[model samples]
Every structure is written in structure tokens, then in C-alpha cells.
Target: MNKITTNAFHPMQLKISQADIGYKEILISGADAQLQSGEVCLLIGNNGVGKTTLIRSVLHQIAILRGTITLGDKNIQELSVKEIAEYIAVVLSKSAIPQNYTVNDLVSLGKYIHYPFYFELSKEDQKEVRETIENLGLQQYDATPLKNLSDGNLQKAFIGRALTQNSPVIILDEPTTHLDEKNKIIILKTLRKLAREHHKLILFSSHDWRLAKEFADKIWYIKDRTLHAGMVEDVLIRHHELTDPSLFNVNEYFKAPHIIAPPLYKEMLYSLLQKNSTADLSHLSFEFMDNRWHIDAKGNGYQCGSFEEILVLVKTLH
Candidate 1:
């Protein structure tokens, strides 16, 4: 595990009190949160909702229009750039990727803050860099130039650099943006592990709330110009929009038939039947047995090999 020693007297929480954040006009206001260390927090909001702006304010890149954000008891404005770097390691989504830097070269940059720019990395720092690379499953690309790596691999490399920095707090802006489903899972799971095992306070913003929620210990949801922070389930339940995306305005135009199968298959079959007819389907029944769909329509019997087959048969009924 990566550990960074800090003054024991300092509190281990990131506290925001009535903070109003924006570059010029306040985009998000009345935000208050007391996020503790040793947990993963996921920041979520719609576009133009100040997710990035709030993150920038927390990093002290942009001044807060009102209220205060503190790391322990010290105001963020009081911390120097180097002091902030020591306390927080950040990975931005739009960070410029260097052209000729290899995986090892990029990841090693994390230790530069602790040493002179011209000085070479110490043996211990080099070992940490190598271990970070291996932990991120980037050993295969350790020597490969970053330009030659895929977008997903490049994103992982950036995360590796942050991990090597080993700050008490790690903040990432959409860390899993360029990753595929598998890679997305890998990165989120790794962050969760780091928070639980290494006790790092991890905060990351992502639009993939459905998948990200599983790995998050808490959620920082910005809505109605306020920041709502709480346990994942609590926040999600408080904001019904998160649980119900409202992607489709599904109407119960057709009554559903008795569906019997595993939950997954049964729901899918019912949805298919409902979508195809506006008339009552309560008289119809479907049961899955022996790996086949046994459907009854009034006094008639039909069978389907698959959902597609069931759909075709359903359309004929309609």
C-alpha cells in the first residue's frame, strides 16, 4: 500500500461549507459536504451543472465565490500550490498527453514533486513507479510510447501516475471516460480497493452513474444548484432521477401476460409482449421450461426458441 505521512493533529476530512463555485457567476451554490478519508466518492450531475467547475474550486484552481472549502481546518486558499500537490493528487480528463513519454516515463513524473526537476528518481521511487505500473496492468506497455497506446491504456497510465503520487486524497475527472466496459470496471474497482485497503480519500466525477454507483461508497450529486452528498443508496433514493433515468416514457398500454421464467428472461418477454400490443394480454401466459418458451394464447398453444422468436410470434398475435 502507498502511504503518505501527515500531521496527526490535522483532521482527515474534506469539508465544504456553503460553498458557491464558479469562474465568474456562481454556477453551483449552497454546497456543503463532509467527505471523510478511506472512501470512494463519485461526483455526478448533468452537463453544465458545474461538476468540473466544482472540482476546480476544490482544487483551488478557481476561487470560490462564497463560503469555504477546507482540507482539515486549513482553508484551501491558504495552501500553496506545492502544499496542495502534497495533499491532493489530481488526474484531469483533458490533461495533455506527452508525445514521446513511455508508460514508465509518465508514471515516474509523479515523484518529481518530491525532488528537483533535473534530479533522477531515487531507487525507492523507481520501485514504486514500477509497482504502480504493474498494479494497473500496464506492464506490457511500460516501455511503449504513450502515443502508441490505446485511449483506454493511456487513461490507465494517467491513473497510475496519480496512484504513484500517493497523496492522501486523489481526485480524478472522469477517470473511466475513454475506457471500455471491462477497462471501466477495472479502474473503478482499483479505486475502490485503494480507498478500502490503503485508506485514500478518492473523489472522481463520472456520467456513468449506473455502473459507477456500485463502486462508490458515497455520492456527491449536484442538482438544483446544490451539492447533495451521502451514502450511495441514500443519495440515489433521495434523487429519484438517478434511480429512474426516465430514458423512455413507458406506458402500460397493454396488460401483461403471466410470465414464468428467470427474472431476467421473464421481464424481457413481458416487455416485448407489451410493446407490440395495445389490447389486453392478461389472458395470455408464458412459461419457460426445458430451455423453451411455452406460451398459451386463449385456447391455443405456441412455443418459441428465443426472445426473437417470441417477438415474431407475438407480432403475429397482434
Candidate 2:
């Protein structure tokens, strides 16, 4: 067995070559990607675009049709399941936890890689588990049953377990799936911290474009048989396919509201235009000093909370 480095600051990378990724047929082909240590990359795509398939291929759960995946100094195909566990920790999208299990129970189970079949957890392991639970804000639910917990809290518990596992690489499939706005930010922020502060490789699939775009250092967009990757700003600006907004005839259809929002609301503005299907967003202008939105328009802007409120605002604008 080859000795692996324990240094967190070491240059660790996951490289993928031209591979066909999917089940039965290729959903994406000739894909290439790489992630270095201390980088947080978000994978974004619509449904059935093989995002999960690519993830499975990296985890070695699914066979690569034709390609190579190298992790650090070793090829992924050459590593055993146990050996791979030493390098990566994964938070699954739909794992079934036992209804009877407690938050602590689930987290303690992460140590089974080191102490398989041992019912007792070592003091060091217990300490790590406690710290992970506390860090994820799961301490209050430490004794709560899995069945009784909210979906967001349950998701956090799963994340805490993955953190306690202590692997250099972490992959999460929609870690913020059931989480509300606040909890979603918490998880994404934690992932970024893990990558930068702890030198962990963080890769995750996310549907919350705003949250992902806000926190991710880079983006890996899977679309049209390609995996586009780069710094978030570069990817957003360079890749037209990822930014192709939904065309809406809002001005011709419904009552369109005037929006004096910041320029960063590109995606949101596009969506609002489509949702209202009556406003023209192409002529929309915005300004922001920092991340906060401030529109520099000639009219008194009416802040709307929903699409219905937008209709009323449009009437007042006229």
C-alpha cells in the first residue's frame, strides 16, 4: 500500500479526462475537469443533465464508459473502497437513516471506517463527533430521533457526519436541498470555510444559483455534453449557454412591473420576466456599490415581495 500524505496544505487534486458519463447512454461526453485543494466548485445544471451520473463516476459507484479519473497521486480506479474512503467523504442526496437513530448515533457511525464492527467509539472519535455536531448547529438535536427532526435539520446532521469523517475531499449532492434561505447560506458558507481554512476539496451540486454563485469560488456548469469550469465570474461571463435566459414577452402579456434593482440580479430579473410573462427585462438597468442592490432610475421604485405585488406595482408605475 502506498503511504498517503496527511498534510492538509499539500497540493491535492481530482482530475477527470474525456469520459462518457451516464446510465446506459451518455448524457455528457468528452468531459474534462479538475479541482485542486482549497477550492470550492459548484456543479450547476437542469434536471436529467447527468450531474449525478458524473458524481457517481467520480465516486467509483458507476463505471466510466471511457475516461480516466485521478485523485491526487493515484488513479481512482486503482483504489479500493476503503482506500478511497480515506481520501473523500460524500453526503448523499437521498440516504435513508434509521428512524430510531439519534443525531449522535448517525455522526458516530462515520468512524466505522477506522473501527468497523466496533460498537464503542474511541474518546478522540467521540470528541470529533461532538465538535462536528456543534459546528453544524446540531447540538440542540443531539438526542433527537431522526424521524422527529425537520428535513433541514436532518440534512445538517448528515453534513455533520460527513465532516466528522475527516476526508480531504468532500462531495455533497444538493446539501441544501430541504434547507430554507438561512440554513442554505449556513451550509454553503461552511463548505467555503472548509475548503479555504481546512484545505479541503469541496464540490457540490446546487439548484440555488444565487447562493451557489455568491459563495462558490468557481462553477462547473454541465450543459450540451460539456462541463464548463472556471472562476464564477469568468464562467458566467464567458459561457453564453449557461446564461441563456428564458425569453419572456412580458410587455405583450401581463402587467409588467418596473424594477430598479442591482445588476447582480441578472438571473432573478430574467426569471421574474418569464414568470410575469408581460414585462421586458432586456432594457432593465441597475447599480450596486457592493453586493447590495441599488437602482439608479428616474422614478420612485416600489419594492415588491412577490409576482402578484409586482402586478400592482406596475399599475402604479403607469
Candidate 3:
């Protein structure tokens, strides 16, 4: 282990290469991802693609078969788990809180990292916890039991826990899964606020490419046996190089207006559009998809082609 002078003001970042764990492997990988003092990043990929594995390796929760992960200039292997916890906060995919615990009690747990030995939270710590709960709109559920709350509220409580940790870096795994559309937006927006307003470095994983592209400053795409990290547009457009299209079905993502829509309407519209002809099947114009119609030569617009044309247009654009 090598020691370097650490600066609290410096940004946190993870650099890794040739790391592997269990049945999963990520080789010949090197990424210069700087989670600026404050910024949000999205980790995206298909199921079992190693996004969680990479995050775990960075946190040193699991052993890395090979390669080094550095936070700033310090190697993660050289730091104790407690040391890492001080700078990084995590929200896991599943939380198993005691069903009897109140929301405030659950959120107050975040303060444990800062005051590990305290039997009771200090006035200031309590104030911070209350504020975090309020900020996340969890005030109404403060006294509610964890098991009594909806999935969305439980998810928000978990976020509040992370916020209470007040770490420079925060990591979440699929925070929006099982959430309604409105809850998804609320969580994403809260994450954005944490990055931009509080200057916290936020990294989260999701299958929602559309939301990730809109909200993340950078994206990490994991596939086959490689890791591609860069601007969302660059990585998404270059997805073909990472894996076989037939195997991964990357084409479905190329659709026009790749926005996250209400589940029922999104599927219905996609199905209907694929049944039509005469639709401009060239580019995936997001504007066109959103408006549900495109202007023709007469300046009057009509609902564009059938579902088939829309699907073709989406593929062509990609």
C-alpha cells in the first residue's frame, strides 16, 4: 500500500481495470471517471452485466481477482471498510429494515457512520435527519412504521438514510425498480438536486436508459465482457460494438422518443405504430414521437405511420 496526502476538498473517483468476481468478469478495463466534487452519473446495462459487481469492487465489499481501484490517488484495497464508509454512502437494491422501526428511526440510522459509538443522536444530528426526511417529502411518514409504508415511501426512506450519512460520494443500485412513474421521477429529481445543489457525487444503476440519459452527466455501459464509459450519447450509439445485437436486443432502445412513458400507453402506442405504413421510417424524431403526429407537405399534420413504420423508423435512426 502507498500513502498519499489526502485533500477533503478534492473530488472522488474510481479507476479500475481487469477486475473480476465469482462467475462475472470485467477485463482489460480502464475508466477515468471523475465524479466531480458534485455531479450525477448513471450506471446502465442489461441484467447480469456486472454493473453491481463493479460497484461492489469499488467499495471493497468483494475481492477483486485482479486490477486496482483508486479513490482519488489512494487504492481502495489499502483503505479499511470504515474509511470507505466515511466517504461513500450506499442504498442497496433491497432493504430489510425492522418492520417495527419508524421512518425517523430508520433515517436516523444514517448518522451511525458519523457517530458510530453514540447511543443517542445529538441535537444537530437529529436536526439533520429531520431536515433530510422533510426534503425527501417523508415528513408524513416520519412516524409510520417501515412495513406499513408503500414501496415508494420505503424507497424514499432509504434515500433519506443515505442523505443522513452526508458522504461525499453516494451510490444506489436500481433505486427506481418497483416504483411507479411518478415515484421514479421524484427519486431521479431528488438525486439531481443532491448532485447539483449539495455538490455530492451521485452514482446509481438503472435499466431505464431514457431516464439515465436525461438525468446523468455520464454513463457507464457494461456488456458482454467490456465496460464503456462516456457521455450517454456516445456510449448508447456505440453499443453495437460491445455485444451482438441479436443477443442483447439493443435495437429496441433505439426507438424514437425513447422517453419513459406510462407502461400501458407506451406498449399500446408502440404496437399500433408498428402496424401502419407510409410513416416516415428514417430517423427517430423525438419531437415527432411526443407530439403523436408529423407535418406533411400541406402543413397540416396527421398521426404518423402504423406501429410497424414507427418501429422501422426507430431502428433506422439507430
In candidate 3, position 103 carries an lDDT of 96
- TM-score of model number 1: 0.80
Error at 21, model 2, angstroms? 1.4
Tell me the alpha-carbon RMSD of every candidate.
5.1, 5.0, 6.8
Per-residue alpha-carbon lDDT of candidate 3 for residues 23-108, written as tens digits (9 for 90 to 100): 34443254434456567888887787678877887789886776677776788888887888887899988878876899998899
How big is the positional error of residue 14 in model 2, measured in Å on the Cα after superposition? 0.3
2 versus 3: better lDDT goes to:
2
Structural similarity to truth (TM-score) of each candidate:
0.80, 0.81, 0.74
Best by lDDT: 1
Candidate achieving higher TM-score, 1 or 2 = 2
Candidate ranking under lDDT, highest first, comes to: 1, 2, 3
- TM-score order of candidates, best first? 2, 1, 3
Candidate 1 Cα outliers beyond 4 Å, as residue runs: 1-11, 245-318
Report the C-alpha lDDT of model 2 over 1-318, residue by residue, as the tens digit.
654554655588888888778878888888888989999999988888888888888999988888888888787888888888878899988989877999999988778766666568879889989988887888999999999999999999888878888788999998999998888888888888998899899999986555556788878888887888788988888765454443223345543334444443654754655564554433333433354434322554434445456445443543
- Cα lDDT for residue 18, candidate 1: 91
Q: Considering every candidate listed, which one attains the maximal TM-score?
A: 2
lDDT of each: 0.84, 0.77, 0.71
